[model samples]
Target: MAIHKLDIGEFDEIDYSLIAIHTSLEDYRLAYFINQKLHVNLNKSKKEIQITVKEGEAHFSRFHYYEMKKDVSWDLIQNKNEVIQQQNENNQSLFSNVNIEVATKVYMLPEFKKVDYFLKIENSENDLNIVKLQNTLNTIDNIATIYLVDTNKIKSKNNLIF
Candidate 1:
């Protein structure tokens, strides 16, 4: 008899720095601003990040940029999305069934509900200067606040994997 076991922690390594951004600009505009300030071309990903919750499926917009020279990857993702849930109402009148669409707020990281977006930087070779990056992001006029999130304290770290 043989036993096989897989340790999930062995494969789970937090190699990325997560930056929480509070901004009023749209995703595209923010991407543009980041490109201008960071000197990286961030393009919209064709496939959006999708999560299934009790309300419905939530789709989050993602912008990505890969610096081949530095071997660093950057991902800018929307933290909150409005998910429309359809509810069927039963009435005694002729219109017995009515479909009502209700919009619910879905957060990629529920713990960071106040953050509008997250900039995730994966520095494979430890070449990226995260402090400098944060300082540059702070210079953006549209950003109200910019701060680094402690990955160790995050409860929904799995949500960030994608």
Candidate 2:
């Protein structure tokens, strides 16, 4: 098997679109080969990028990894409570109080490139749910989100600070 190298940026996140092979290649062999060459680790979650080496198809994909770039404003984060308050202010029925927790300072959106592991589930943002929140944030740049480490309901987290 021959390996080709591409110009992967220092912080560029990987997605399926980065896969360049257009031909119908054997997926298993392809994945194994890529995994062997790339030293791709397999036992990661949907929140991790790895080559999925299966029966007949070998492929690399973002799978479940989330990448966040740091460019967040202090105003957005410090005033998060206010923002939530304002957002939930009008729609008392929707964004109103439920449960909110503050993570450690490190979990707060970083000012530079890094991974955030905690979240302070906002009182108002609970209705949309974490999965929905993740889907919504995926479209925006600079501002990106991930699932809470464990709890599904109130664990929405922004990976990057923006």
Best lDDT among the predictions, by candidate number: 1
lDDT of the candidates, in the order given? 0.91, 0.28
Error of 2 at 56 (Å): 54
Number of the top-ranking candidate, with TM-score as the measure:
1
Q: List the residue pairs that clash in candidate 1.
A: none
Across 7-109, the per-residue lDDT of candidate 2 in tens digits comes to: 7684353211111121122333333433443333222233321122222212122212122232211111111110111122433676566455423222222
Model 2 poorest ten-residue lDDT run:
73-82
Instruction: Report lDDT (Cα) of residue 78, candidate 2.
Output: 18
Clashes of each: 0, 12
